[model samples]
Target: MSSSRAAVAGWALAACVYLLAQLHRTSLGVAGLLAEQRFGIDAGQLSLFVFLQIGVYAAMQIPTGVLVDRYGPRRVLVAAATIMGGAQLVFALVPLYPVALLARAALGFGDALTFVSVLRFAATHFSPRRYPVLVALTGMTGTVGNVAATLPLALLLRHVGWAPSFLGAGALSLVAGGAVALLLPDSTPPPRAVRTAAELRSGVLSIRGRVRRAWALPGTRLGFWTHFTSMSTGTALAVLWGTPYLVTAVGFSTAGAGAVLMVGVIAAAVVSPVLGWLIGERPSVRVPIGFGLSIVVVLGLVLLVTAFGDTPPAGPVVVFFVLAALGGPVSMAAFALARDYNHARSLGTASGVVNVGGFVATVLIALGIGWVLDLQGGTTARSLRWALLVAVAVQGFGVVRMIVWWLRVRATALHRQQRGEPVPVSVVRRRFDLRVTGPTGESGPGD
Candidate 1:
């Protein structure tokens, strides 16, 4: 392949891994009640199926990043796909809940291995100028996976039965892994200072030390909080709650609920490139835009439930899903922040830390909502509405912290500029005011 074609092929295959990550991540949302029916589990246990996968995915981020550094993306990518496919096959045939849980856990492991490796891999393949748009598209590709897992997967389940559907899913995963192996262009690891990574792997540098060092940057934390507030609620909704709540609580037909989810994913796909361009054109807007998105989405959802109760009007509910899906693209700003502020060598760890924010939110809040549903004796209109309110509360809390960290990042940027440092200055919009912030901690490149 020509170099450009090779880059595209590699990126495309890597994106396939991410696509599966999102597919499995959101599979249970469509499949949740079915899984419950098959396993005879309650809401809380059903939540465990989704939440545990995410919890494991979140917990693996930093470690997976380290492994990508210590080993390489190829090994990690191949292993991840194999594990995911095999686990899904196991999940398809399993008759026991505990075994299913173990299968989901393995799936999470494979899912966790993907994006970091993909990001690190992309860093090696593409020029820095293309990075922002590429990151956004990565998220968009995952949303496409979400689309497939929705109505298509739902239809497959109806037509083919559970085991056959998932068997096909497993087979697809294995095929994707094989394609990646054959097509992704080989590249040398990007050069970077290895002392920190070397010691970190050898246990000379503690995991806490590396994590604390990365998190110590106010910009990194800003990215974390930005994603924490903006991303996960949409993810939580998409993962296990949106379809059920829409159908059972808001009087959406099953097809209507599936269409709503497909709408969200498609909307996210459309927005990702626009958001990526904004971030690339004006770095300052990264955090500010994320802040704005979180506030608007949280307020919109809050108003929807509070005003309409369980029987929200369809038109407004459609607006809510569009707004919520927009958050997925906005959250990509966190990666831009991590790329902007951290050194290239440290990018993997910082990215992993940044990556954890949303899924952590996804894990805790999804699990909490499941418990709340269980406590209320299932997905009643009242129970589902209350559960979503709980999600808003968490999102609201993240926005509060985002404000705190946003201010600190701005201050840190101003301080660096005053000290005769090289920072990419950009205009930040504040209430009735304009201010300055900084990024491109490196001269010509960013994450």
Candidate 2:
């Protein structure tokens, strides 16, 4: 078989695991009420229960990145599939709420393993130029799984009853794991060389040292804040509270809420590639001072109104959904920023650090909403407005921190530019056009 074909086949299978991971990650959002009924829990307890999955996933990322680096992506992908499959089965069959929470935590652990593995797989197998596009597609695939967990999972639960629906989903994931174990090809190996003592020492650096070094970079911190601010609300909505809020607050039926969420996911998927292109190719289009903050602020204001105000008209609710969808893809910009500022050697650590912010923010947002709902006496329309306002307030704080870091990074970049060292093109946005020119004087790909 051609090497190219093997790469594609392997990615396709690993991507299935990622899809399952995302499906399970957001499964509680659709199943929140059902789980609540089955487990005999209040809205606040249910929120805490569901958000545990994401919390575990967020906390495990750096460790999981280490696993992928040491053990390789294929093995990690298989293990992730196996763990998630078992967790889902436990979630399906167990009548006890405590066991289900443990299952969700396991599912989150598995979910943490899958994304880093998929990224390592792509980085190993694909050419550099195609890597960014493939990464965008990977995110889009996860979005597809996220969309499925909404209406499709809801309909499945509706028709088949909760146990059969989740049981079947679990069974499918187990099968995917087996197929990956048996059929997936190993990543193409790079040429080996004798390692120097310094290289070996670097690889064994303590986790604290790795994180501290990465955190010291102003751009890395900017990336963290960007990820934190941009993705938390959208993710909280999709992964835990979005559907319930829509149904309880906006008078949408189960299917209607799912449909709206599904549309937003699809819209976000479509917009992702365009954003990826703008960042990778036409970066000069960015306004140096604020970068992507304008759209983020607009999305925040929309959420503020949607969450804090009295049951808004349907128009604003729909607008918030559309706008929040954009936030997911927008968070991808944070990774781009990490790539821009960090050395290639420290990129993985920086990326993992950046990755933590969004999910950490997500867990906090869900908790905030859940606690507020309890305070307001349940999940009524009036209660959700207050609940979501608490969540959005958390997001606003993240945005403020992002701006603070952005100013510092900008100042640092200017210092580097003044010293005549190479800096990321984004640092010079609107100050000067720095694209390379071809023979005919046309701008290069950096244009």
Best by lDDT: 1
Candidate lDDT values, in order: 0.81, 0.74
How do all models score by TM-score? 0.91, 0.87
The lowest-lDDT stretch of 10 consecutive residues in candidate 2 is 438-447
Candidate 1 whole-model C-alpha lDDT, 0 to 1: 0.81
Per-residue alpha-carbon lDDT of candidate 2 for residues 197-229, written as tens digits (9 for 90 to 100): 877576667656777877777767877888888
